[model samples]
Target chain A: MNPAFENITSLRAKLAARDITPTEVIEALRARCTQVEPSVSAFNHLDWDTALREAATADASLPLGGVPIAIKDVIAVKGQPCTCSSKILKGHTAVYDAGVIERLRSLGAVPVGRCNMDEFAMGSSTENSADGPTRNPWDTSRIPGGSSGGSAACVAAHEAIASLGSDTGGSIRQPAALCGCVGLKPTYGRVSRYGLVAFASSLDQIGPFTKTVRDAATLLGAISGRDPRDCTSLDQPVPDYTASLEQGVKGLRIGVPKEYFIEGMDKDVEQTTRQALDQLAKLGAELVDISLPHTNYALSSYYIIAPAEASANLARFDGVRYGARVPDGKDVLDVYSRTRALGFGNEVKRRIILGTYVLSSGYYDAYYLRAQKVRTLIRKDFEEAWKKCDIIATPTTPTPAFKLGEKTGDPIQMYLSDVFTIAVNMAGLCGLSLPCGFVQRDSTDLPLGLQFIGKAFDEATLLRASHAYEQSTEWHTRRPVL
Target chain B: MNVEYVAKLARIDLSAQEIETYQNQLGSVLEHMDAIASLNLDGIEPTAHASPVFNVLRKDEIKPSLPVEDALSNAPKKANDLILMPKIVE
Candidate 1:
C-alpha cells in the first residue's frame, strides 16, 4: 500500500510491523507531491533531500516514528525558511526549532515541507499569500479556505499523511472544512506558541490537519504541554488525547446554537450540518437547543482586537534585524517604511494600518478597549452555554469553498467567510471541523463540514464526540481524485 | 479614517491609489465594527487574554543563549558580531 495516502495511525502500525521503512514513506510522499503539487500548490518550499536524510536514520519505535508531517510556514523549524508566505521574510531561515517542532522531533516525526499561508496569517483565503494561492483539491477552480489553506489542501490531496496549521480565526478549521479534512484548534494556551509567527497573540493556537479524527488526536497529544519559553502556555498536564477517542458520544449533550444558523447561509450547508446533528442524536447523544446571544458581535470585535494586537506584534519586521531591506534609504525611518511597504502584501498592509488606527491615541478607547470588553461578553456566552452542554455544534462555514478570486475583490465579503469559525477563537475555546457530507455543485461534489466547539482544554471530549460522529459516517473516507 | 496618517503611523508607505483603496475598504470595515459602539459594557472586565496566567516568571538562572553569529544570521546588514543599523543620532 502507498503510505502517502494512508492515515498516520495505519502508517504508525505499518512502520512498527516493518512492512515499510521511513525512507519508503518519504519516497512515496515525494512521488505524490511531484504529481499533485503543481496543481495544488500547497507548499512554499519542500526539501526532499533533507527529509530523506532524516528518514534514513528515523527510529521507528517511537509513537510517531518515521512519519512525515507537513508544517505551516509560520512555525519555525531550524534550517527551514519560516516565511509565513510573505515577501518580507523571504530567504530568512529559522536558526532554532519552534516548540512544536522540538516536540514532534522528539517523537521521531520528520518535518517535511513549509506549507503556504496568508501573509502574516491575516486573511481567511490563502489568496493573500505572496507565494500564490493554494487551490482546493476538491474543485480546482475553487479556493481552499485559508491562512492554513495549504495545510488542509496538502492533506486532502494526499501530499502528506498529516500536517500542522495554526488557527487565529478559523484558519485551520475553515480551510479544513473547505478542503474536506479533519482540522482542530486546541484551546488557546493548550499548545505553545513560542515559534508561531503571531497573528493575533491571544487567539492563535497551532493545531493539525489530518485525514482522520484519530490522527488529529494523536498529533494534538504529541505537540501539547507547557513550555518555559512560551509564558502563556497553560501549566496543565497534557492528556493522552487518543485515550478517549473510542469512548463515543452516548448520553453527551451536544449544544446546537440557534445563532449559527443565520439568514443568508447556504441551504445545502445548513441541511448537511443539521443532518450530521441528527446522526449524532440517533447515536444516543442528547442534542440541546442553545443560544449564544452575543454571537453577532464576535466578528466585529475580532476585527478590532486581532488587528490591534497584530499591529503591535508585527512591529518587529522593521528592516533592522532580519529579513529584507531596501538599499537606498536616506534615514532609519525611510528604511523602515520602504522595506515594510515593499515586503508586505496588500492584505497584510491593510490589517497593519487598521490595527494601528484602532490603537491610535484618541481611538483606543472607542475601538480597541470596547472590543476587548465585548470579547468578555462573547467568552461569557460560551461559559454560560457550556453549563447546558458538553460541546457545541455548528456549520464550519456558511457555504462550501467558493471560486478562486470570488471574495478577493471585497475584504468584508472575504471576512464574512469566517463568520462561523471566528467566535470560537474570540472565546479561546477548542474547536474541530470534520467532513459531514457533500453538496453537489456544478456537476462536482463539494464537501460540507460540521464544527464542534469544546470547553477550554477539553480536547478529549471534543475528539471523542468527533470520532464517534466521523465513524458513523463515511465522509472521512472520501478523497479528492487529483 | 485618515488612511494616509494611519499608514504613516504604521510606517508602511502606501501609494496614492493604494491609500484610496484602503480608505474605502477600511471605512466599510470600521462601519461594520460600529456595532460594538452601542454595547453597554458596564462592569464588564476586559479579557486581554483567554488564559488566566499572569506575570509568568522563569528562574533567573544562567542558560546558554543563541550565539551572536547565529542570532545575527538573518540580519539584513551586519558587522563582525553586530547588526549594523542606520544612525539614529542626526
Candidate 2:
C-alpha cells in the first residue's frame, strides 16, 4: 500500500496488520526530521537513538504503539528539559513526567523530541523563541502560529504523527488553525497542568495538536483523566473520546457567533468559516446566529487576569528557587534583580511587569479587580448563547499565518492574533480549532481554521460537530510539502 | 509611562533608543485596548475564573518534592550542594 500519511487510527491498524513496523515508522519520522529540521526548526531536543530503541519494543496491543509524537518544550517529559523555550531554564531537566506524558507512555507513544515554542509561551509567533524561530512549513517566510508553533508545524509538515501542546490563550488552536491541523483545548481542568510550566495557571491546559480529528481524539482520550497530583484537575471520569467519533452530528445545534464577524477579519477567512457552517448544515446540523455582546471586552479582561495570575505564579522563579541565577550580587535583592533581568526575555519581562503593575496595591481595583468583573460578563455571554445552541462556531483567527517578523515589532498587532480566541479562554469553555479550508493569500496558500466552542464540559458535542465537518471536508487531508 | 518606571518594574536598564521604541509600541497597544474598555457591561457579572468550586481547596499541604540534590543540581553556583547566589535584602 502506498503510505497513507494521515490519522493515527489507520497508521495503528497498518501496524497491527504487520503492514508497517514500529521501526519503520520511527525510521521514516527520523528521516523526515533530518530533512525538515533546517527548514522548520521544529524541535529543541531530539533523541533519535533512544526513540528507535523504544519503538523497537512496540507491542500491537497498545493503542498508539509505535507512533512518533512531538512534545512541546513547555511540558515536562521526565528527565528531559522542560525549558518553556527560555534561556533561564537552559540546563534544567524535569524530575518527573507530566501527567499527560505518563498518559502518552501508557498508550505506547514514542517521544520523538521537544518542539520549540514562544519564550515562556509569551508570543503569538515562534519568532520569540529564545533558541530560534520555528519557520512555517507552508511558507518559510510566514510563521507557523505559536506558542504551540513547533508542534503545529511539525505535525502539519509530517515531521511527526501527532504532538502534545499547551494552550493558555489560543496557543494550541491558533497554531493548529494556521497550520491546517486539529487542536483541542479540553475544559480548563479536563487535562492536568501539573507538568505544564505555568504561563497563566488558571488559563493554561495541555492538549494535542494533530493532523486529523481522530488522531486528536485518540490522544485526548489517553490524556483526559484526572490526576490527583493536580489540584485543578476535574474529578470526572475520562470518556473514550474515540467511541463518539462515529456518532455523526445529525441533530447537533451549532451556533455561529455574530460578534466574531467583525470588521478587519480577512474576507477569505470569513468566507471559509461560513462554508464550514454550510457543511455542517448539509450534515443535518442546525445553525443559529447568536450574539455574544461581551465578546468585545474579552481581550481586556484576559490581559488583566492572565498577567495578574502569571505575576504570582512566576514569582516562584526567584534567584533562590528555580531557574537562572546571577553569579555576582551585593545582596538577595541584587541577585533577584540580576537573575530576573538576565533570565527572562523582553516579552516575558514586559508581561511580568504589566502583571505586577496591575496586581499592585494602588492600581489593583482599577485594573485587576475591574477586569475580573468584566470576566464574569464574558462567561455569561457564552452561558446565554449556549442556552440556544450546543456549540458556537467562529473563525479561529482573524487571518491566516502572516510573514515572520511582520508583527513581532508591534506587540498590539501580535496580541490581536488572539482576538478571536482569548474570549473562549476567559469564559472557561472548551474549544477546538479544526482546519476548515485553505485560502490563497498573495502567492502562497495558507490554511484557514474554524473554531467550535462548547459550554463547560460540553466537549463531546463540539467534537461531534467538528468530526462531521471533517468527514465532509478534504482540508485536513492536505499536507505541507516537505 | 517613563522609561525609568518600566526599567525599574522589569529590573533592567534601557538605552534611549529602547525606551523611545517601547513607548510607541505600548502606546498603540493600550489605545487598541480602548475597544475592550468601552464595552458596556452594566448588569452582567464578570467571570474571574472557570471552576465552580470556590474556597473549597484545602489548606497548604506539604507533599513530596524533588530532593535537595536533584533540585539544586542544575544551579550554576552552589556551596555544599546548596544553591549559592548573590545576596541582598528585599
Q: What tens-digit string does per-residue lDDT give for candidate 2 at A345-445?
A: 87776677677777776777667777877888777778898789988899999999999989977787898899889988887788999998888877788
Instruction: Please compute DockQ, using alpha carbons, for every candidate against the native two-chain complex.
Output: 0.88, 0.48
Which candidate leads the pack in TM-score? 1
TM-score of 2: 0.94
True-structure Cα RMSD, model 1: 0.8
Residue pairs with backbone overlap in model 1: none
Interface RMSD computed for candidate 1 is what? Answer: 0.8
The reply for model 2, stretches above 4 Å from the true place, is: A1-6, B6-17, B36-46, B56-65, B87-90
* Candidate closest to the true structure, highest DockQ: 1
Per-chain TM-score (chain B), model 1: 0.92
